[model samples]
Target: MREVQPVATAHLRRDETGHRRRVRRLPLVAVGALVAATAVALPQFTPDAKAATTLRGYADGRGVKIGAAVGDGPLTSDSGHTAVLDREFNSVTAENAMKWDALEPTRGSFNWAAADRLVAHASAHNQGVRGHTLAWYAQLPSWLKNGNFSASELNTILKGHIGTKVGRYKGKVYAWDVVNEAFSGDGSMRGSLWPTKLGTGYIANALRWAHAADPAANLKRFSDLGLEVSVTELDVRIPLPASSAQQSADYKPASLNPNE
Candidate 1:
């Protein structure tokens, strides 16, 4: 197992009496990798040691554990392969696999039959779980497609969605995808009606509300809307980014027209 250690240091530009002061230094981790890049020389290793390391890495030991991910819904369950996956992995990740829309298709209606089973199974096996996707622009319910609501109404709706979901799985959730795809790859914040109406603080509010409901929640938000964007001119000149990027959708079944 590779141990992760952090190093912290600071440098003083000038003395306090003069003008400049010392600034804090960020911690750094030093770890060597065998195959960091596609082309790189590997360390000299005897055949015996190489095979041993490979076997040991896959064994349960004192190291960072891996987890399997499967949506807990009517269409999925912890069976044959999932049981093995749950046993092998120590954590799980979800994008829109586990979100408000998928769980609660209708407003104020809760569905826990599927997720609860997985949560219970994880707890029984001592495995960690990741609750994905609380807020985002896509994968929303049909009602939100073109429905126009006031600022206050929007805020209420967004908050309600986050609070109930995060609150329900507070204790068991390892971390959360608070808001996904809310920004461009350039690092600038993404645009959404919630931000325009409720303001930039909506992010802070989401985190706060999530924390209040689930104080122990570990929040992870993403906003890279353009990271893998694709523009289409087939329908009303729908504008987007390059269609060959890492996240392009030119060949997606959910493209312009599903039936097409």
Candidate 2:
């Protein structure tokens, strides 16, 4: 008979300042015995004496990928900051270069210089790129928002935008946040222009169009193919007249339940 052994899993929590606060350990209920029974030890080889000492090196040692959100200003003007970013992170996300307004400020004309520079830098450094977003409500040009168009016309416009952007960076970008902030805090879809103009089906159409544009994208599972949503920005607003202690308590680190 094979001996049954317990396997431990850790859940790490991050505080408001992006620091690891605490770790909670949980035991795997199933597959723990099988894992222990089939576990094998391989001969270990020592790493180089003068191994890399940066954050990216540390993450590589532990088989993890670390990334950062960067802006065009530092990438172009600040060499020191750019050096630190390149040396410390294996992946990069453009803070605003790939947004709708930046890509297509005027109708039927596109500018790709700023975003292209970032992509070129990341490629030179052998770092993976994450496209910020494909469709969003804010930061949109005045023309897109104020233009007079029917639902069908808007649908065509949305598809064309997704195809142009995603197709341009098809193989270069590893992941894309196809849609952003689609939901409110109350678990309902936010009242964004997409839903208001094109109805709920617009999200599905957006994902479909993105996939059609870039069939080779490294998306999630099939069910979640083009719905690779991300919480790019998170803000917590505390009411006034609150004490420091109360504010601190309110800012407690969020807990993640890995079992779920």
Candidate 3:
């Protein structure tokens, strides 16, 4: 069985004015129902040039110790011997997730070529690629700043943005950040282009739409600069990593183990 992931409830269930607050949060979506869960790789732990030699030595005789998230760029089609490097360490990540100004400077338009190239390269060599994010308070288009629109119009905008992005990669993207950051430490939802107009439902709506766009995509929510976002929508308790230390025991840390 796949392991349950930790939730962000502690951050959401905080005290207010010296009293307990009844802040409710959404749970994780039924990931297994929609798709087989994707396993997240631990971040790179070593950066030494000789780290490879150390690892090689381990593989050669010492032991078979290898990191899960190890990666490098442009090795698939490198003119130099970098292609060989990619073949050796095939896992890589997308970097331009923070550069929204270059991605979608205009409303309803996207420049996915740069990212697509990376995903294509990784897929060609039988590797995995992660979509860094779907939404962030920072790195957003100025057009989205306090934009005026009806709720229906706002939902359409959000749907278009997420659907296009999530659909473009489809199965190529092993995982996706369906909704990046949508809450504050005080258990309040983050006000953004969607929430400001579409309110709380925007979160679930985004997840639902993205799930349909790519059923095989693994859904992940992040906030507070890389912290997992766990919300309890309706009754689904997505166990996200805690955003802070103020949570109750019900929201405990859980492992997201690989599928059996």
TM-score of 3: 0.53
What's model 2's lDDT at 3?
A: 29
Candidates 1 and 2 compared by TM-score, better number:
2
**What clash pairs does model 2 have?**
none
Using lDDT as the yardstick, the better of models 1 and 3 is 3
Winner by lDDT between candidate 3 and candidate 2? 2
What order do you get sorting by TM-score, best first? 2, 1, 3
lDDT order, best first, reads 2, 3, 1
Each candidate structure's TM-score, on Cα atoms with residue i matched to residue i, is: 0.57, 0.69, 0.53
Candidate 3 residue 187 Cα shift, in angstroms, is 4.0
**Model 1 residue 166 distance off true place after TM-score fit, in angstroms:** 1.7
Off by over 4 Å in 3: 4-90, 97-100, 216-260
Best by TM-score: 2
TM-score for candidate 1, residues paired by index: 0.57
Residue 149 in model 3: lDDT: 69
